[model samples]
Target: MILAATGMRREARIIARAGLVPVISGGDAGRLRGLLTAQAARASAIVSIGIAGALSPELRVGDIVVGDRVLIPPRNGEGDHPQGGGGERATFGGFAGPSTACGGPPPRDKLGEELLTVLPGARRGVACGSDAMVITAAAKARLYEACGGTLPLIIDMESHVAAQVAQEHGLPFAFIRVISDRADQDLPPAVTCGLKADGSMAILPVLAALLRKPAQLPALIRTARDTDRAMRSLLAACDVLARGGVGLADRG
Candidate 1:
């Protein structure tokens, strides 16, 4: 079976198939690690599939990125964690800690190559993993520069953890992400308030954020439109996977 790890419930639902088991991180790194640990043994291969933020200025919404490698930022200290409330300290062994530093590349796996066969026009690039969302254009630019020559083209919440788990178990791993926000854009504050731990949307918190900053409505609308486009692309990609039987074909 394939272990499909994603950040939201919507993404999990989209990738659900006869041979795939979907696990949602819901923006929490610790939870993602735990879920992957529990499911990794049952999976022949692992895949991280969902929408992601673009880290390259040239990428626009709905562009598909197949990660050739996943990069984790170097640890500052014990307290320094990914944007969310997870203690992803840099260490070795298992999914508890990832092995790669910001510019370091992990071992290449065949899962990404297989995904490209089913996902036509998908760009293969490096993916940077973050605990928190990269919300502003300036922050995205800084991260892009910080990686130096590695040049991660996309950023997301779950790929690093998924990669670690796959490595720990000696399983092939893949990362397929659709861009929802571009590097030049700043995500509206309301975008951060809309998700719940179970990966469901929380309308009240988003409404409260909008009430506090009414002027952000236009940006929020644009974000919504971009997300819609990304979702459509993700759905199409999932359809191709299902039809092509990429993940289902291999039971190793």
Candidate 2:
């Protein structure tokens, strides 16, 4: 079976058409580990799908990224507590750069030979996942450098967990992330500010909040348009590979 992860409800809403109800694991490595620990052996393939911010200008909003490696920072020392210490609630967001600073090991490559045949234009990239999404020039630069200057075609929160789980179970895994924002862009603060803890977009509240900043409306519209395009592209890619039994990436 294919396992897909979509970070937020909006992103998840898009994949509903795939007729695959994504398992809502909240994107925490610990939580994901537990879920997969039991079922890992049964899963045929794992996929992490979601929206990510672009760390390089070469990638535009709405472009797609299919990853071969996933990087996640390790958790802080627990001191034998096993849990607790007031960490952020289990929520999915974006990539955290480097494993040493946090607590995770280096990314594991688990993309099997079969899936690669489906991803044609996927660039070889090390996708880093973090509790927090990387934004701003400094953070992006740090992650970019950590990857040895190879521009990240995509970044997301759940790919690392999928990769780790696949590794533990010796399963084939691949990550497909659609770019919702570019390197020069940040999610309109207003949109995120109105979001509740449960990942639902507070549309009216967000709009009310943004009413004062008419300047952002244009960009928001543009992002919406781009995101729509990306979604269509993703489904097209999936259909071409999943139904036709062809691996697009094999051409690479």
Predictions in order: lDDT: 0.75, 0.56
Q: What RMSD, rounded to one decimal, does every model reach? A: 4.6, 7.3
Model 1 spans > 4 angstroms off:
17-19, 75-108, 149-152, 245-247
Q: Estimate the overall C-alpha local distance difference test score of candidate 2.
A: 0.56
Clashing pairs in 1: 83-132
lDDT for 191 (candidate 1): 85
lDDT by residue for model 1 (18-103), tens: 34678898888889999999988877877888999987888989999985466665532222223322333242212223443233
Return the lDDT, model 1, position 175. 85
Write the residue-wise lDDT of candidate 2 on 91-193 in tens digits.
1112334322233433444353344556666554556565554544445555544444464645566676676666556556667777777766655545444
As a TM-score, model 2 comes out at: 0.68
**Model 1: how far is 107 from its true place, Å?**
7.6
